[model samples]
Target: MDIRPTDRPDRRTFAIISHPDAGKTTLTEKLLLFGGAIRAAGEVKARGAARRARSDWMKIEQQRGISVTSSVMTFERDGLTFNLLDTPGHEDFSEDTYRTLTAVDSAVMVIDAARGIEAQTRKLFEVCRMRSVPIITFVNKVDREGREPFALLDEIADQLALDVSPMNWPIGMGGQFEGLYDLEHDRLMRPAADNARGFEGDVEQLGGMDDAKLATLISSQGLALLREEAELAQAGYAPFDDTAYRHGDLTPVYFGSALKDFGVAELIDALARFAPSPRPQPADPAPISPDDANVTGFIFKVQANMNPMHRDRVAFMRLCSGKFRRGMKLNQMGTGKAIAVHSPILFFAREREVADEAFPGDIIGIPNHGTLRVGDTLTDGPPVTITGLPNFAPEILRRVALKDPTKTKQLRKALDDLAEEGIIQVFYPSIGGQWIVGVVGQLQLEVLISRLEVEYKVDAVLEPSPWDTARWISAATPEELKAFTDLHRGALAEDRDGAPVFMARDTWELGYVSDRNRAIRFSATKERN
Candidate 1:
């Protein structure tokens, strides 16, 4: 593959994270807009006031206003290329965030100035810290109601225990909100004057608050607000003493309403200026030796849609270390399948693909290559192993018993394929123990059901979820086992009604018996004729 350096593209990878409804998606949309990925910025709820998340693509996701999966995009600004990983803010998909965090270099923790630090924000911040990923906090929604920027900044520092320093402070929050006091520039950049299309004269000289407030700041408040234009003219960036707030060195805070397009250009500028790129760092670390080593990439995720014709996936991959070109003979790490690279390019969501050969530290997509799976490393020649991704066993469990037992075999095969694609588990427990399935969340379960009935032409029975034995366990008593067996036998004797009734009663009995220190053998129970 032929490759050329694009004028020192800053090797910075950043993930946008925050609690649900904290404007993470809004911030992402604004960033994408400024990066020229999308010509126009779309609202989260453009459909008759129904909020639509740009990153969320699932039907269930559009119906519900929450992000269930991670959406990644890449853009370039000022010769710096950024791999922007946008993650779900909900706690249910926290594992997804954890997995995506491994591929990124830094994080942009988007927080609502009004709501401050939330439970999910705290949990996610802890995850970033555990990985030692540097962060730049953006106090978003300054134009929203009940915002208190300073208070929220303090809360972030206290609650999340972050070394957060405000590089920009909001002039006034909520309705009266105008712009920010750029600590580095000492200029007040505010909202546009309604008619202004882009970054116009929205920013004006504030004269450093009123005289009374200035005196109050000096005597009672913390730092003195610089004396406007004169201060900005003197120092280009923040002072050397203000090394505490330099880009790349410390957490630089910015404020604006992403929805209103306020302070977005400045945010993009900050991202390009402050965020570090992937250059100079040992991008490819797979091969033990340097000489004659082929390029290797690690697959972080796989995206699949239901419609057969539109069955395309973008594998979020990191060039572990090696050079790869178009049509390169790439082999999966453990598999012998030699898959040819179609068009190697950086992916800005599925809609945007830039023509460029990806190198170390670059996140790109491999199209139409079905052989690669998550955690599989693809190399041009001999296999080289990199560190494995963090292991997260699926927690949510469910089961579906086929209604037409005649189609059980077909259902099992279809569900198995679904399981592989969905990163879920499907299995039949014993000879006729129904089918036990596992997924990451409830939405996934619904998708599985839909695929079964719609895609596979299998009419399946979704039985009520059984109580997890691990959660409610106790020693099994003979009497309890006998009661359970009696119930099961009665249900079997009664046929269809008997099975459901007996299954329900048996489940309850197991719970009661186990709670009272007893175990029942349900998996090996005899089927009464």
Candidate 2:
């Protein structure tokens, strides 16, 4: 098949990542505002009758003012379709964020100017680096008192091990905040004081280094400081190199206050001009190219009951190549069965519209009916699996049961659907087949219970399990697997996907099992083939 350059230049897919309360959601809203996706940008925390952030549509998220699940939003700007994957900032939901990252081509790292690099930010950055995904840094909350611009850049370079290229320089920080200097265009952007959350600003063309108007706007002292820093940044910092960025070696940094809507347009403009389009995705047997004739994609997320009015499930699929029509037939890689996609929906937060056709880098929602699961690949060609979706070992274990015995079927279906979404890992003991759930944290358990009661109308109770750790077992041969299972018959259980798992009561028990069974390998994570 012949593939040509510029075949998918109009597409751009990226994710927004940050630590909790670092203004990640705010930044997302402002970007949507610039793209004309929303008429008025809403605050993350709004009072009575005020609209909340469109990206945060879930009831829990709206009430808590925090994102617990990743949201996919798409917008069109300058003839380019941009898919923005807004990830959860809470550390408790990092697993979901990690999965979301796997589906994006690039990432936008939002940093708090005052706090600098944070724990969650570092973890997310490491994942990005591992994938070699290009990153764009936005030093947020410059409108408030925060770190010095140079110091923030230094921190990013020293901590993240990324070469920093300052695309624009901040005029003044905190209360004295004036605006920004456009380095490439040699222009001064003076944001209107009353333009908070609106897309209106003033620009002044800087003729030379010694402009009198610059001194007047920022005061003489501030101008001197700006000039000194600007000269130093130009001479010392690395220039923005597209090659380095594509390889994840360098990052272009922009300073802005997302809350006030200042300096947002500049960042969006840069993404439109330089960010990469949909690229080839790695799949089993062979990599899938964007210009491939057959339709191909993967389900990275499965959300159940997005709308309370209708108990519906939507599988979020990222189109890696080819065009996806509303009623196209494709092979489910997991099941090896051809299925027709009848409802391919596009999303603007929770609001969705049926999409007639979609291209590479677009995320379309497929109405699911117990057939889809996270990490399942779909294609019109031969069955090809995209690996690297991880099933992390759960830390918290609970033996859960339905409050009403008559609703057994309802409880089973609810648990299965939630487990399929990766919200929690459900396990069945070998002896009685009792349901035991394994989760990364207690918050996940809470969310699962809340969802069951609210969405599924099933009441459940969780009792503490004695196990502290769980591991998946792998053997070289059938005999070895049988022998291992026979020896530890009582400890064996099956995960939600029916994979064998061994639960240990404590570290000592785990060590004893390892010493006793020398042939079996215990793994903390499971990789799909």
Model 2 Cα lDDT, one tens digit per residue, 1-529: 4445425778889999999999998899989888877666863222344344478887677778888889988888989899999998887787888889888889999999999999999999998998888999999998889999889999999999999999888877887777778787878876675745222577788775578777766677768878998899988889999999999999999988888877799889988877888878878889888888778999999998888888799999989888788899989987888889998999877777799999888899999787888899999987788777888888889988878888888988999988888888888888764688888877788788888888888999988786888999989998999998987878889987778899999879998998888899999998753
RMSD of 2: 3.1
Candidate 2, residue 396: CA error in Å?
Answer: 1.5
lDDT of 1 by residue, 1-529 (tens): 3334422235677788899999887778888777765666553322245233277665556677777667767666667777788887887677667767767767888888778888988888888776566777777777767555556756766776655555666655566554566655546665555743224545544344444434432222223333442244234333222244332334666777777776677777766676555422222243322223367667766665522456455566776455556777788766667877778666544444444576556777776535565666677767565553543334465568777889978786676555434445553332256655655556666666766765567887666545232121112565764565464442221111122112223446646644553353333121211
TM-score of 1: 0.72
Give candidate 1's error at residue 385 in angstroms: 2.4
Scored by Cα lDDT, where does model 2 land? Answer: 0.85
> What TM-score would every model get versus the actual structure?
0.72, 0.95
lDDT of 1 at 110: 83
Show where candidate 1 strays beyond 4 Å. Answer: 1-9, 43-53, 194-201, 204-250, 279-293, 306-308, 352-356, 368-370, 402-418, 421-423, 427-433, 446-461, 465-529
Alpha-carbon lDDT, every model: 0.59, 0.85
How many pairs collide in each candidate, listed in order?
19, 0
